[model samples]
Target: MGVRPPQNDDDEPDTITFGIAALDAHLERADVEFPVDAETLLTQLGDPDIPYDATGSTVALSEAMDKVHIQHFDSEQELLNTLHPVFESYRERAGNSILGQLRALLPF
Candidate 1:
Protein backbone atom coordinates (compact mmCIF):
# COMPACT_ATOMS: atom_id res chain seq x y z
CA MET A 1 0.00 0.00 0.00
CA GLY A 2 1.05 3.58 -0.59
CA VAL A 3 0.40 6.77 1.29
CA ARG A 4 -1.65 9.59 -0.16
CA PRO A 5 0.32 11.82 -2.51
CA PRO A 6 1.21 15.42 -1.86
CA GLN A 7 -1.59 17.86 -2.77
CA ASN A 8 0.77 19.85 -4.97
CA ASP A 9 0.76 18.69 -8.60
CA ASP A 10 4.49 19.33 -8.95
CA ASP A 11 5.26 16.48 -6.51
CA GLU A 12 3.45 13.90 -8.68
CA PRO A 13 5.17 11.45 -10.94
CA ASP A 14 4.21 11.43 -14.62
CA THR A 15 4.66 7.65 -14.99
CA ILE A 16 2.60 4.82 -13.57
CA THR A 17 4.97 2.83 -11.37
CA PHE A 18 3.29 0.00 -9.55
CA GLY A 19 3.44 -3.71 -9.05
CA ILE A 20 0.82 -6.22 -10.17
CA ALA A 21 1.05 -7.90 -6.76
CA ALA A 22 2.32 -6.05 -3.70
CA LEU A 23 1.65 -5.23 -0.10
CA ASP A 24 3.23 -1.90 1.02
CA ALA A 25 5.15 0.50 -1.12
CA HIS A 26 8.07 2.93 -0.53
CA LEU A 27 11.02 0.63 0.07
CA GLU A 28 13.88 2.88 -1.03
CA ARG A 29 15.28 4.61 -4.05
CA ALA A 30 15.67 2.24 -7.02
CA ASP A 31 19.14 3.54 -7.70
CA VAL A 32 20.53 2.27 -4.37
CA GLU A 33 22.69 -0.81 -4.74
CA PHE A 34 22.15 -3.86 -2.58
CA PRO A 35 24.42 -5.52 0.02
CA VAL A 36 23.77 -2.50 2.13
CA ASP A 37 23.80 -2.01 5.88
CA ALA A 38 20.82 -0.94 7.96
CA GLU A 39 22.44 2.41 8.69
CA THR A 40 23.06 3.04 5.02
CA LEU A 41 19.52 2.08 4.06
CA LEU A 42 18.18 4.27 6.80
CA THR A 43 20.33 7.12 5.61
CA GLN A 44 19.33 6.67 1.97
CA LEU A 45 15.62 5.99 2.44
CA GLY A 46 15.02 7.98 5.61
CA ASP A 47 12.82 6.61 8.37
CA PRO A 48 9.56 6.59 6.43
CA ASP A 49 6.31 6.01 8.22
CA ILE A 50 4.61 3.10 6.51
CA PRO A 51 1.22 1.53 7.04
CA TYR A 52 0.97 -1.94 8.56
CA ASP A 53 -2.63 -2.59 7.57
CA ALA A 54 -5.75 -1.04 6.07
CA THR A 55 -7.03 0.29 9.39
CA GLY A 56 -4.69 3.28 9.14
CA SER A 57 -2.16 1.50 11.31
CA THR A 58 1.44 2.55 10.82
CA VAL A 59 5.00 1.82 11.96
CA ALA A 60 8.20 3.57 11.15
CA LEU A 61 10.19 1.55 8.65
CA SER A 62 13.21 2.08 10.91
CA GLU A 63 11.38 0.49 13.81
CA ALA A 64 10.63 -2.63 11.83
CA MET A 65 14.19 -2.71 10.58
CA ASP A 66 15.32 -2.72 14.20
CA LYS A 67 13.70 -6.12 14.70
CA VAL A 68 15.87 -7.61 11.99
CA HIS A 69 19.09 -9.04 13.47
CA ILE A 70 21.15 -8.83 10.35
CA GLN A 71 23.87 -6.24 10.06
CA HIS A 72 23.70 -6.15 6.31
CA PHE A 73 21.37 -7.46 3.62
CA ASP A 74 22.51 -9.20 0.46
CA SER A 75 19.50 -8.02 -1.44
CA GLU A 76 16.22 -6.19 -1.06
CA GLN A 77 14.43 -9.52 -1.03
CA GLU A 78 16.51 -10.68 1.93
CA LEU A 79 15.71 -7.52 3.88
CA LEU A 80 12.02 -7.85 3.08
CA ASN A 81 12.03 -11.51 4.03
CA THR A 82 13.52 -10.60 7.37
CA LEU A 83 10.96 -7.89 8.06
CA HIS A 84 7.96 -9.89 6.83
CA PRO A 85 7.36 -11.64 10.13
CA VAL A 86 7.78 -8.40 12.06
CA PHE A 87 5.13 -6.69 9.95
CA GLU A 88 2.85 -9.69 10.29
CA SER A 89 3.21 -9.61 14.06
CA TYR A 90 2.39 -5.90 14.14
CA ARG A 91 -0.60 -6.41 11.85
CA GLU A 92 -1.88 -9.27 14.00
CA ARG A 93 -1.43 -7.19 17.13
CA ALA A 94 -3.34 -4.32 15.56
CA GLY A 95 -6.10 -6.61 14.32
CA ASN A 96 -6.54 -8.17 17.75
CA SER A 97 -7.05 -4.86 19.49
CA ILE A 98 -10.49 -3.37 20.16
CA LEU A 99 -9.51 0.04 18.85
CA GLY A 100 -8.07 -1.54 15.74
CA GLN A 101 -11.36 -3.29 15.13
CA LEU A 102 -13.26 -0.03 15.47
CA ARG A 103 -10.75 1.75 13.28
CA ALA A 104 -11.10 -0.94 10.67
CA LEU A 105 -14.85 -0.40 10.73
CA LEU A 106 -14.55 3.37 10.47
CA PRO A 107 -11.37 4.63 8.83
CA PHE A 108 -11.73 8.09 10.36
Candidate 2:
Protein backbone atom coordinates (compact mmCIF):
# COMPACT_ATOMS: atom_id res chain seq x y z
CA MET A 1 0.00 0.00 0.00
CA GLY A 2 1.06 3.61 -0.76
CA VAL A 3 -0.08 7.05 0.29
CA ARG A 4 -0.33 10.01 -2.07
CA PRO A 5 -0.22 13.50 -0.61
CA PRO A 6 -3.42 15.36 -1.19
CA GLN A 7 -3.24 18.18 -3.70
CA ASN A 8 -6.14 19.93 -1.99
CA ASP A 9 -8.50 19.57 0.93
CA ASP A 10 -11.06 17.85 -1.25
CA ASP A 11 -8.62 15.21 -2.37
CA GLU A 12 -8.43 11.96 -0.49
CA PRO A 13 -5.75 11.78 2.23
CA ASP A 14 -4.61 8.33 1.12
CA THR A 15 -4.45 6.63 -2.24
CA ILE A 16 -4.25 2.87 -2.51
CA THR A 17 -2.09 1.39 -5.23
CA PHE A 18 -3.95 -1.60 -6.59
CA GLY A 19 -1.00 -3.17 -8.31
CA ILE A 20 0.22 -6.74 -8.92
CA ALA A 21 1.55 -7.37 -5.43
CA ALA A 22 -1.71 -6.49 -3.74
CA LEU A 23 -3.66 -8.60 -6.18
CA ASP A 24 -1.31 -11.54 -5.78
CA ALA A 25 -1.47 -11.38 -2.00
CA HIS A 26 -5.24 -11.30 -2.05
CA LEU A 27 -5.44 -14.20 -4.50
CA GLU A 28 -2.97 -16.21 -2.47
CA ARG A 29 -5.10 -15.80 0.61
CA ALA A 30 -8.26 -16.61 -1.26
CA ASP A 31 -6.72 -19.73 -2.81
CA VAL A 32 -8.10 -19.01 -6.23
CA GLU A 33 -6.70 -18.62 -9.72
CA PHE A 34 -7.77 -15.75 -11.89
CA PRO A 35 -6.78 -16.33 -15.49
CA VAL A 36 -6.56 -12.58 -16.18
CA ASP A 37 -3.44 -10.58 -15.57
CA ALA A 38 -3.57 -8.44 -12.42
CA GLU A 39 -2.89 -5.22 -14.26
CA THR A 40 -5.54 -5.91 -16.85
CA LEU A 41 -8.12 -6.89 -14.24
CA LEU A 42 -7.32 -3.87 -12.12
CA THR A 43 -7.58 -1.57 -15.10
CA GLN A 44 -11.00 -2.95 -15.91
CA LEU A 45 -12.16 -2.71 -12.32
CA GLY A 46 -10.80 0.81 -11.97
CA ASP A 47 -12.28 2.27 -15.10
CA PRO A 48 -14.88 0.41 -17.05
CA ASP A 49 -15.43 3.39 -19.33
CA ILE A 50 -11.81 3.59 -20.44
CA PRO A 51 -10.76 1.40 -23.33
CA TYR A 52 -7.89 -1.00 -22.61
CA ASP A 53 -5.60 0.38 -25.33
CA ALA A 54 -2.51 -1.77 -24.80
CA THR A 55 -3.73 -4.35 -27.32
CA GLY A 56 -6.71 -2.55 -28.78
CA SER A 57 -9.03 -3.95 -26.19
CA THR A 58 -12.60 -2.69 -26.11
CA VAL A 59 -14.39 -0.98 -23.25
CA ALA A 60 -17.27 -3.44 -23.20
CA LEU A 61 -17.42 -5.40 -19.94
CA SER A 62 -18.37 -8.75 -21.46
CA GLU A 63 -15.73 -8.44 -24.16
CA ALA A 64 -13.05 -7.58 -21.66
CA MET A 65 -13.95 -10.50 -19.36
CA ASP A 66 -14.10 -12.83 -22.35
CA LYS A 67 -10.71 -11.65 -23.54
CA VAL A 68 -9.28 -12.51 -20.16
CA HIS A 69 -11.22 -15.78 -19.91
CA ILE A 70 -12.72 -14.87 -16.52
CA GLN A 71 -15.14 -17.67 -15.84
CA HIS A 72 -17.22 -18.65 -12.79
CA PHE A 73 -15.94 -18.34 -9.27
CA ASP A 74 -15.49 -21.27 -6.89
CA SER A 75 -18.26 -19.79 -4.78
CA GLU A 76 -20.00 -16.46 -4.18
CA GLN A 77 -18.34 -16.00 -0.80
CA GLU A 78 -14.93 -16.69 -2.28
CA LEU A 79 -15.60 -14.17 -4.99
CA LEU A 80 -16.69 -11.53 -2.49
CA ASN A 81 -13.82 -12.24 -0.16
CA THR A 82 -11.33 -11.96 -2.97
CA LEU A 83 -12.81 -8.78 -4.43
CA HIS A 84 -13.77 -6.84 -1.28
CA PRO A 85 -10.21 -5.78 -0.53
CA VAL A 86 -9.62 -4.64 -4.06
CA PHE A 87 -12.83 -2.65 -3.91
CA GLU A 88 -11.85 -1.08 -0.60
CA SER A 89 -8.44 -0.16 -1.97
CA TYR A 90 -10.02 1.45 -5.00
CA ARG A 91 -12.92 3.15 -3.20
CA GLU A 92 -11.44 6.61 -3.27
CA ARG A 93 -9.99 6.41 -6.77
CA ALA A 94 -13.04 4.79 -8.33
CA GLY A 95 -15.05 8.02 -8.47
CA ASN A 96 -17.97 7.29 -10.82
CA SER A 97 -16.76 3.89 -11.96
CA ILE A 98 -19.02 0.85 -11.65
CA LEU A 99 -17.30 -0.41 -8.53
CA GLY A 100 -17.55 2.98 -6.91
CA GLN A 101 -21.24 3.17 -7.68
CA LEU A 102 -21.77 -0.31 -6.33
CA ARG A 103 -19.84 0.56 -3.21
CA ALA A 104 -22.23 3.42 -2.65
CA LEU A 105 -25.21 1.10 -2.89
CA LEU A 106 -23.81 -1.81 -0.89
CA PRO A 107 -22.93 -1.44 2.78
CA PHE A 108 -20.23 -4.06 2.48
Candidate 3:
Protein backbone atom coordinates (compact mmCIF):
# COMPACT_ATOMS: atom_id res chain seq x y z
CA MET A 1 0.00 0.00 0.00
CA GLY A 2 1.00 3.62 -0.48
CA VAL A 3 0.35 6.65 1.78
CA ARG A 4 -2.87 6.64 3.77
CA PRO A 5 -5.04 9.33 5.35
CA PRO A 6 -4.98 9.36 9.14
CA GLN A 7 -7.72 7.25 10.60
CA ASN A 8 -10.37 8.36 13.09
CA ASP A 9 -11.17 6.46 16.29
CA ASP A 10 -14.93 6.48 15.51
CA ASP A 11 -14.13 4.31 12.46
CA GLU A 12 -16.10 6.23 9.85
CA PRO A 13 -15.47 5.13 6.27
CA ASP A 14 -14.85 8.60 4.88
CA THR A 15 -13.02 11.49 6.46
CA ILE A 16 -15.86 13.85 5.50
CA THR A 17 -14.56 17.38 5.89
CA PHE A 18 -16.89 20.17 4.78
CA GLY A 19 -16.88 24.01 4.42
CA ILE A 20 -13.41 25.52 4.17
CA ALA A 21 -12.05 22.15 5.15
CA ALA A 22 -13.27 20.65 1.88
CA LEU A 23 -11.73 23.47 -0.19
CA ASP A 24 -8.18 22.38 0.61
CA ALA A 25 -7.89 20.76 -2.79
CA HIS A 26 -9.22 23.81 -4.61
CA LEU A 27 -7.21 26.39 -2.70
CA GLU A 28 -3.96 24.54 -3.23
CA ARG A 29 -4.34 24.57 -7.01
CA ALA A 30 -1.84 27.01 -8.56
CA ASP A 31 -4.20 27.79 -11.42
CA VAL A 32 -6.70 29.52 -9.11
CA GLU A 33 -5.79 33.13 -8.38
CA PHE A 34 -7.49 35.41 -5.82
CA PRO A 35 -9.89 38.20 -6.89
CA VAL A 36 -11.38 35.62 -9.23
CA ASP A 37 -14.83 35.90 -10.74
CA ALA A 38 -17.41 33.27 -9.77
CA GLU A 39 -17.70 31.71 -13.22
CA THR A 40 -13.95 31.60 -13.67
CA LEU A 41 -13.48 30.10 -10.22
CA LEU A 42 -16.04 27.41 -10.99
CA THR A 43 -14.40 26.62 -14.31
CA GLN A 44 -10.89 26.51 -12.88
CA LEU A 45 -11.98 24.34 -9.93
CA GLY A 46 -13.53 21.87 -12.36
CA ASP A 47 -16.49 21.37 -10.03
CA PRO A 48 -14.85 19.45 -7.21
CA ASP A 49 -16.91 17.10 -5.06
CA ILE A 50 -17.23 18.78 -1.72
CA PRO A 51 -18.23 16.67 1.28
CA TYR A 52 -21.58 18.23 2.33
CA ASP A 53 -22.43 16.81 5.70
CA ALA A 54 -21.85 14.20 8.40
CA THR A 55 -23.30 11.45 6.16
CA GLY A 56 -20.24 11.75 3.91
CA SER A 57 -22.37 12.59 0.88
CA THR A 58 -21.21 15.40 -1.41
CA VAL A 59 -22.36 18.23 -3.63
CA ALA A 60 -20.30 19.76 -6.42
CA LEU A 61 -18.47 23.00 -5.78
CA SER A 62 -20.25 24.37 -8.82
CA GLU A 63 -23.60 23.72 -7.14
CA ALA A 64 -22.62 25.89 -4.21
CA MET A 65 -21.17 28.53 -6.48
CA ASP A 66 -24.43 28.75 -8.36
CA LYS A 67 -26.25 30.01 -5.28
CA VAL A 68 -23.59 32.56 -4.42
CA HIS A 69 -24.63 36.10 -5.40
CA ILE A 70 -21.17 37.61 -5.30
CA GLN A 71 -19.65 38.25 -8.72
CA HIS A 72 -16.03 38.30 -7.55
CA PHE A 73 -13.92 37.35 -4.56
CA ASP A 74 -11.09 39.60 -3.44
CA SER A 75 -9.48 36.82 -1.43
CA GLU A 76 -9.89 33.18 -0.47
CA GLN A 77 -11.36 34.36 2.82
CA GLU A 78 -14.13 36.21 1.02
CA LEU A 79 -14.95 33.18 -1.07
CA LEU A 80 -14.98 30.89 1.94
CA ASN A 81 -17.16 33.24 3.95
CA THR A 82 -19.66 33.55 1.13
CA LEU A 83 -19.85 29.82 0.52
CA HIS A 84 -20.09 28.83 4.17
CA PRO A 85 -23.84 29.47 4.40
CA VAL A 86 -24.42 28.03 0.98
CA PHE A 87 -22.77 24.79 2.05
CA GLU A 88 -24.89 24.83 5.21
CA SER A 89 -28.07 25.07 3.16
CA TYR A 90 -26.98 22.06 1.13
CA ARG A 91 -26.19 20.24 4.36
CA GLU A 92 -29.65 21.01 5.70
CA ARG A 93 -31.27 19.84 2.51
CA ALA A 94 -29.23 16.65 2.47
CA GLY A 95 -30.09 15.95 6.07
CA ASN A 96 -33.72 16.11 5.10
CA SER A 97 -33.33 13.66 2.24
CA ILE A 98 -34.93 10.23 2.55
CA LEU A 99 -31.58 8.51 3.00
CA GLY A 100 -30.64 10.95 5.71
CA GLN A 101 -33.95 10.26 7.46
CA LEU A 102 -33.17 6.56 7.15
CA ARG A 103 -29.77 7.16 8.67
CA ALA A 104 -31.41 9.01 11.52
CA LEU A 105 -33.13 5.78 12.50
CA LEU A 106 -29.75 4.16 13.01
CA PRO A 107 -28.71 3.88 16.66
CA PHE A 108 -25.11 4.80 15.85
What is the per-residue lDDT of model 3 for residues 1-108, given as tens digits with 9 covering 90 to 100? Answer: 011234557575544467667775567874678889988887888878888666667788877787877889999889888988888888788779898898767644
The ten-residue window of minimal lDDT in model 2 covers: 49-58
Q: How close is candidate 3 to the true structure, as a TM-score?
A: 0.73
Predict model 1's lDDT versus the native.
0.64
Better lDDT candidate (1, 2)? 1
lDDT of 1 at 45: 70
Off by over 4 Å in 3: 1-14
The 10 consecutive residues of candidate 3 with the worst lDDT sum are: 1-10
Q: What residue runs in model 1 are displaced by over 4 Å at the alpha carbon? A: 1-24, 28-30
Per-residue alpha-carbon lDDT of model 2 for 1-108, expressed as tens digits? 333433556755654333333443444555544455545544545533322221122233333334433355555344445544444443345545675566557532
> Candidates ranked by lDDT, best first?
3, 1, 2
Q: Worst lDDT window (10 residues) for model 1?
A: 15-24
User: Global CA lDDT of candidate 2, please?
Assistant: 0.42
